[model samples]
Target: MRELIVTNEPVLISYAEALLKDQRIEAMVFDRNMSLMEGSIGAFPRRLVVSDDEWAEAAQILRDAGLGEWVVGNARK
Candidate 1:
């Protein structure tokens, strides 16, 4: 899997997941357990990960949804 978006905003994570699902892309949210680990303090950000083969299309979907700024790493480079 490859990282798609890493963010502190839980809502954005949910929204992105839904968008990806609509596009038939499977995604997983990493660090979600951090909320329990940190006592729901929201300090540790969550990560959205997609399969290696689906990353490019998933990133484009996110970008089209006006979430391009939230993407992380060298996926675009």
Candidate 2:
């Protein structure tokens, strides 16, 4: 799996998930429960991840949605 985006903003993650879903791509949000460990201080950014096979498509969908700024890692592969 590869990370599509990582951010402290919950809304951005939600938006990215929605966009990916709209394109028939399934995404997994990691560290969502980290809030419990971090005392809900938004210190740990949630990670949106997808399979390596789906990374390109998922990255394109997010970038098209104007979320390119939040994307992480080398999506080109």
Candidate 3:
């Protein structure tokens, strides 16, 4: 899987997941347990990832939904 977005905001993660799901893209949330174990201190941000082949489409779906700024690395632009 390729990491797409990393953030401490749970709402944003959920929103992004929903958007991707609507487009028939599968997304996985990583580090959710770690973040919870840390008591949501924001130290361990959750990661949204997709299969390597789906990464580009997933990123574009997020970008088109006004979440371009949240896409990881050069994918944000």
Looking at candidate 2, the ten consecutive residues that score lowest on lDDT are: 68-77
Preferred candidate (lDDT higher): 2 or 3 = 3
Tell how far residue 20 is off in model 2, in angstroms.
Answer: 0.6
Tell how far residue 6 is off in model 3, in angstroms. Answer: 0.3
How many Å off is the CA of 72 in candidate 3? 0.6
Compute the lDDT of residue 76 as modeled in candidate 3. 49
Local distance difference test, per candidate?
0.90, 0.87, 0.89
For model 2, how does the per-residue alpha-carbon lDDT over 1-77 read when each residue is reduced to its tens digit?
Answer: 89888899999999888898988899999999999998999999899999999988888777777777777864544
lDDT of 3 by residue, 1-77 (tens): 99999998999999999999999999999998895588767898899999999998888888889898898874544
* TM per prediction: 0.91, 0.91, 0.90
Rank by lDDT, highest first: 1, 3, 2
**Per-residue lDDT value at 54 in model 3:** 92
Model 2: lDDT to the true structure: 0.87
